[model samples]
Target: MSQNTLFDKVWDLHKVADLPGGSSQLFIGLHLIHEVTSPQAFGALKDKNLNVKFPSRTIATVDHIVPTDNQSRPFKDTLAEQMIDTLEKNCKKHKIKFFNIGSGSQGIVHVVAPELGLTQPGMTIACGDSHTSTHGAFGSIAFGIGTSQVRDVLASQTLAMNKLKVRQIWCKNRLSEGVFAKDLVLHIINKLGVKAGVGYAYEFSGPAIDLLSMEERMTICNMSIEGGARCGYVNPDQITFKYIQERQFAPKNENWARAVEWWQSLASEKDAKYDDVVLIDASQVEPTVTWGITPGQSIGVSQKIPELKELSIDDQFIAGEAYEYMGLSPGQAIKNTPIDVCFIGSCTNGRISDLRVAAEIIQNHKVSPNVKAFVVPGSEKVAKAAIEEGLDKIFKEAGFQWREPGCSMCLAMNPDKLTGNQVSASSSNRNFKGRQGSPSGRTLLMSPAMVAAAAIEGKVSDVREFLKK
Candidate 1:
């Protein structure tokens, strides 16, 4: 068991009682709901004749099924429209705050909460979406819950769960030029193997992590679930505090001072003990891209895919499957692999900073004639910020579409989807088969800058080349 780490501290702080089966009843400080998952839970609540236990603690938004292109009344996708309508009616009936489309706050549930200052240190946050671990970037204990657990949170505001062991992943040095948080996290997942984190909560720390901005930290934590970790977090510091200081829902005046004081105390002690620890040199990580089905099946853009014998026994089967699905040879280099679509958005890398980085790399360049490229901001606020800074103009002039804020092609629940066997250079997370809405569509995950570079070249190109000049 880990002791005195942020995970331990936050878990203990939120533990309401010891359940009979060695699991603790943990109180969720924040609950976030979306259109796709909340409808079923709300229906369950109606069957049980229950109301949201703490309406103010929960927030609602429509994201998963909302089309990024046409968001007019009565969505083109009838089911999507019904989902959003149900969420709206449920939120109103329960007196919960709902950030509807065009509210300027509505977007991906994960992206909207943090920007609004609803995600803070030492809180236990739960969402009905897998990326809820994104809130952990603020030194909180957060994780995704099933629909049943969503109902549990709404009805009682707590969950029964056993504690997870803590693993401290100490990154030694700063990332090299052109290597963003996305690349670093992909590298970490590749090295650790996806299931290495099955029973653990990852504590991401060290000088390398400390140097990242809040948005970058969010990117790292956002994909912890992809690595099979229950959740991931960075210790709160001046960087975290600065990011939260003046947001819409953040504490004000003297409350701000007190909040910071408390948050500062939540970092792990210098001598804290962890159940496990791993160390890596972040400076060595390069622009990374997924070549296979899972997030862990990735290599540096300049490296060749590993041969089956070169992979561990546990990974060989998946490697073979990935090779067939991706239509690539084991010894082939990932570079120059043709791409059909270029998508740059999602809770993973859809923030204003992400757009700015992609735009910078795309300046004076145009999307390849063979590629379909677009950028979807994470939220209405993110979209507004990018437009204010003229990012939209840069993208449009570079032959990329600047779409409305929503989850977009990350999951392909909307109109933005890949057709046939099209290959995509995507900044969004996940490369699972059929994940982009085409049974045969292939997705290669990379950083936003890398996605931009690929969009320009119509292949998997090293982003560092663009950074050199």
Candidate 2:
């Protein structure tokens, strides 16, 4: 058990009661819904004749199935259009705030909420999507719930769950030039093994994490679920408060000071105890990439793939599977692997900072004629901001398609997908089999800047080489 940590404080503050089986009934301060997962939950509410317990606390948006290229109404995909329609109808019936297409606020559920200042420190946030832990970057305790839990929250505004142990991941040293936050998280997941954080809430602390911007911190927490942590968070500080201060839904004026004071108080005490602790030196992290299907099967760009015999028995089984599925051999150099597509988007890496990094590389560089490349902003606001800064022009002129905001190729629920056996250099998280729509397609996860470098070379090239230019 952990004490005096942010996880403990937020959990204790929101605990409504302890149930018979040792599960605590925790009240959720915010509920976010999306088209793909909400339809079934809203339908469940209809079967029970229940209305949202707190409509104002819930927000709705459409993202997964929305097309990034052609977003015309009455979507060509009948099922996608139906899903969006159901969400719109349900939000209207329940009187919940819905950011529909062309609303200027419409985007991925995760991106929309945070930008609107709906994600604040010390609040318990829940979403039907696994990456809901992204909101935890603001010092909140956030969780990704199942569809059944979604119904539970809508009807009662609370969840029953066992508490998690806290693991303090202390990062030290400053990241070297050309290394991005995405690379840091990938390095963490690669080192700790995917399941190391099971049953634990990760407390990302230390000077290295503090140096990261709010969006960069979000990138770290966003993939916390991928590392098998129940959730992950960083203590709120000046960076967090500055990011939230002028946003659309942030507390304003007289209330802003009170909010800041309360948020600051939620930080862990200097002598806080944790169940476990792991220290990592940020200087050792390079531009990292996922070489195999799982995020755990990753290696630095300059490194060679692991030999099967060198791995532990438990890891050998998956290594063989990865070798066959990825069409890669043991001890092969990870760089120079040809890629057919390059993508820069998703809740994980589609923030404005991500775009700026890629744009810096795309200037005076052209995408390889053999490669297909595109950039999809995470939200309408991100898209608008990028356009204002002329990032859109940089991408378009560099032979990359500039797309509208949505969860594009990240999941491939929409038209942005990889064809059979095509290899992709993707900025989005996850490299699972068949994750990018095509059953045989291969995905290599990397930072947005790495993806840009790959797009230019038509192969996996070291982004540091481009940074030097």
Candidate 3:
């Protein structure tokens, strides 16, 4: 058990009561829903004839199955169209706010809410998507719920859960250029193992984390679920407040100052005790890429693949599976592995800052003829911001397609998918088998900048090489 940490504070604040079986009834302040997961939950509600308990606390959006390339009415995928329609109808029936397609706020649920200032510190947030932990960057407690849990929240605005032990991941030093928040998170996953945080909530703190922007913090916390943590968060600070202030849904004027004060108070006490702690030196972290199926099976871009004997027996088994699936031999360098497609978008890394960083690498360069590359903004706001800064043109001139906003290629529920056996340099999270639509497609997860460098070179080239140019 952790004491005096932000996780403890936030959890205790929102705890409605202690239930039987040692679980707590936790109140959720924000409920984010998307087309893919909400339809069934809404259907369950219809079956039970229960209206949304707190419609104003819930927000809806269409993202998962919407095509980034062509978002015209009546999506070509009949099922996708139906899901979107169902979400729209349900939102209307419940009178919940929905950020539908073409709405200026429409995008990935994770991406849309934060930019709108809907995710605030000390609140408990829940979404039906695995990456709902993305909202935890605001020093909030967020969890990804199953469909039944979605129904539960819609009916009662609360969830039953056991408390999580807290792990303080203290990062020191500063990241060098060409290395990024994505690379740092990959490094953490690789070192700690994917399941290390299984029964814990991760508190990412210290100099390295403090220096990161709110978006970077989001990227780190976004993948906490992949690391097997229930959630991850950073203590709210000036960076968090600055990012939230003036956003569409943020408190204004006197209330704004009071909100900041309360958020500041939620920070962990100096003498907080954690169940576990791990320290990482950011200076040692390099531009990283996932070489195998799981995010934990990653290595620095310039590093060689691990030999079976170099890994623990359990890791050896997983590595063997990876070697067979990825078709790469032991000791093969991750660098220079040829790639066919490059995708740069997702809730994980599709913010305006991510686009700017990728655009910086894509500028004055051309995508390799052998590679097909594209950029999808996380939200309509991000897309509009990039266009204002001319990042879209930079991408287009670099031989990359600039697509409309949605969760494009992240899960490949849409038209933007990898062809058979194509290896991808992706900025999005996850590299699971068949994750990018094609059963045989391979995905190599990397930072948006690294994806841009790979797109230019048509291989797993070192992004540092481009940064030095």
Q: Highest lDDT: which candidate?
A: 1
Tell how far residue 95 is off in model 2, in angstroms: 0.4
lDDT of 3 at 341: 96
Q: Report, for all candidates in order, the number of backbone clashes.
A: 0, 0, 0
For model 1, the superposed segments whose C-alpha errors exceed 4 Å read: none
Q: Please write out the lDDT profile of model 1 over residues 1-469, one tens digit for every residue.
A: 7999999999999999999988999999999999888888999999999989999999998888888888899998888888888989999999999999888899999999999999999999999988998999999999999999999999999999989999999999999999999999999999999999998999999999999999999999999999999799999999999999899999999999999999999999898999999998999999999999999999999999999999999999999999999999999999999999999999999999999999999999999999999999999999999999999999999999999999989999888899999999999889999999999999999999999999999999999999887
- Computed on alpha carbons, the lDDT of every model, listed in order, comes to 0.95, 0.94, 0.94
Q: Determine which window of 10 residues in candidate 2 has minimal summed lDDT.
A: 309-318
> Residue 444 of candidate 2: its Cα lDDT?
97
Off by over 4 Å in 3: none
The count of residue-pair clashes in candidate 3 stands at 0
lDDT of 2 at 310: 77
lDDT (10s digit) by residue, model 3, range 171-213: 9999998899999999999999989989899999999999999
What is the descending lDDT order?
1, 2, 3
Q: For model 1, which pairs clash? A: none
